[model samples]
Target: MEEYPISFPMEKARTIFRCSVITYLRNYHRFAITAATFVGIPFTFAILITQAILPISDLLPIVYNRLRTLFFAAGFPPTSEFFFDLSLKLSQTITSLVLLLPFTFSFHLLAKTYVVRSFRNKNGSYMSTFISLFFTQIWNSFLVLSANSLSFFLVSFTFSCMEGFGFKSPNVIIFVSASGGVLYSILLAHAYIISNLALVCSGIEGSVGGGYIAILRACVLIRGRTATALALALPISMAMTAIEALFHYRVMRAYRNSNNITVIMAVEGILIAYLYSTIFVLDTVVNCLFYRSCKGLNLAKIDGLENCSGDDSAEEDMKNLI
Candidate 1:
């Protein structure tokens, strides 16, 4: 591979990334209020009505069966009857909406930050960004998120298929799953960065083409630095995963009563809603900062925010033309 000259304000960009995450944490109360109202409350209600409010035994049969089915067979579709039809006390439709709709809205809100922080400063109204993104950015993000989910499922299926052969052991399973998971995660993170950049380029700049073309353009712009980008991103992503897992384990153990699944789910919902509120902002803002550092560079300026120096001729040409 030919090396391309690239220069970016490494120290400054690093500061920006750290500062952005810090800023979100500092103001997390504001984000928490919104997430709690929308995501947390509804998710809690769904859990309470479907599982927790009832005795653990009531929900246990259904959950155990569902788990067994999923473990034994291919996973259900996103729109499976299994999701839509419940047999217990809750109305299946309302419960589904409570659990699903808020999350859908929340994702749009999260993705909006990619455009807001990239193009605007701290003083910008997050409310306005939420409104604007609902109309413009959400669909593209939906597509990208869907693609990522499908990709992950495919990777998981591939690993499962490999396991169907005579190659199954504890260490082997752990090693293969961890290795494949990391690779898949890194690739997905890159795609997410590109997808968000595509949305920003189109929404902010307006001439960057729409939909998959812009996303592909983003791919072209980030061709060389996948591993480097992952190096920066993976730490944060892994940290989020670890935190989520730790909390989950703690909650599960603490609420081990057989009749408390809803209570556990409700608590987890509140925790996750708040965590995601800040983390999503952190993720979108940091990735945008990375994209901006490489914004006008000629090389596929990626991952090397601190070490990306390259030809200015292409950048200058773009500036002149724009």
Candidate 2:
């Protein structure tokens, strides 16, 4: 059998990420339009609605503004004090918590179509793939949210137990919280990763099971290369964070001088929405390409996929004999 990576090959992973970016660029315009139409406008409206009613609005960083200012949309209906407060908190919580999966749902078909065309060299029905991933993600969401809440609660409870046992020193509490939070973060991140892998695998394998089995299979597929994936994902994440911060600074400055409707903020919101859609699709493509590599699939036959493929027929033959 041919040797596979037992540890991450840093250089090869960079190459993989570069290729994914190229694929994204080729499909960028269409992807951006789809994102803005479905994900962008709706999310922007949600933010506006939430901010309008919530009296204490800084819950959202950077964009939060007072209701009486330019932040308020033109001609919004007036609400009673009780109703406005109730609506504000409810909308803000719901919008903040429930945004990602729904946005992903809107862009799923377009993303899968790009993959099927780009990697598989096949013309598959984008709508069908979108519909399938939609239902699959809904089921996956319950598992993910439940586990996250439970893990977080357990971590908090452990710290509470330590405090109860009289480890009441400030220094000790700080040490424990920092260390425990890091450990919890790593475990939760691992779970998140496999959950996404399961999502990609479900699309590839066309099996439902709410992505649970796919998550396990993905864990096996990703085995020694988790660090490789993270190495590639982190830099992009950092760059995106920097871009967001820069945009926020500009928006804050713009908000100071102008009381009229803010074009700068609107444009920033649209661009960020596009970037979010891009990142989600890019992550999916990366996992797909990596999974294909692990499977020893002959992807060279699939035009643009040549950049992503290797000669791994020997590994495939070995698996066949087994």
Q: Model 2: which residue pairs collide?
A: none
Q: Which 10-residue span in candidate 1 carries the lowest summed lDDT?
A: 299-308
What's the distance in Å from true for residue 70, model 1? Answer: 15
What is the per-residue lDDT of model 1 for residues 61-164, given as tens digits with 9 covering 90 to 100?
56545544653465322333332232222233223434455554665445454334344423345555554445444455555456555654664575567657
Candidate with the greatest TM-score versus the true structure: 2
Tens-digit lDDT track of model 2 for 1-322:
5444434367546556655555455556544455435644454344333333344444543222343232123222233242244234334544454444453465454454445334544434555555545555665666566665565456456656775686666666556556655665676667666666666666666544224666667778779768766766676567655645554455544564574547767787566545545565566666665666556653233454434224354223223311
Q: Which 10 consecutive residues of model 2 have the lowest summed lDDT?
A: 68-77
* lDDT comparing candidate 1 with the true structure: 0.48
Superposition error at 181 for model 2 (Å): 1.4
Task: Return the TM-score for each candidate structure.
Answer: 0.48, 0.65
Q: What's the C-alpha lDDT at position 237 in model 1?
A: 70
User: Residue 46 deviation, candidate 2, in Å?
Assistant: 7.1
